[model samples]
Target: MIPVELWPIASSLKGELLQMQRPQERFAFIIDCFKTYLSWE
Candidate 1:
């Protein structure tokens, strides 16, 4: 399971991504968020 603190922030960001206009923009946001999460590991 994901840690409590990180899960909510990640989830919120992912939800926010739905508002993005284009697929490329959403993909970039997801990629950036994934990188940020990996950096924390």
Candidate 2:
């Protein structure tokens, strides 16, 4: 599952790109990975 705070930003950045407008786009967007890294680890 994906994180909460990152969902919006990821979707937003995904929205910004043409090929990233899909649900699985986050798979390609490093924002998700970055968010995970910046989280309380």
- Which number leads on TM-score? 1
Q: What is the lDDT, from 0 to 100, of the residue 21 in candidate 2?
A: 57
Candidate 2 residue pairs in clash (backbone atoms < 3 Å): none
Residue 7 lDDT, candidate 1, scale 0-100: 84
- lDDT tens string, model 2, 1-41? 76897799767765666555575774656666678778957
Stretches of model 1 off by over 4 angstroms after superposition: none
RMSD of each: 1.5, 5.6
lDDT of 1 by residue, 1-41 (tens): 77797788878887899789899999988899789879978
Write down the lDDT that model 2 would get.
0.68
What is the Cα-based lDDT of residue 25 in candidate 1?
94
Model 1 worst lDDT run, 10 consecutive residues: 1-10
Off by over 4 Å in 2: 19-41
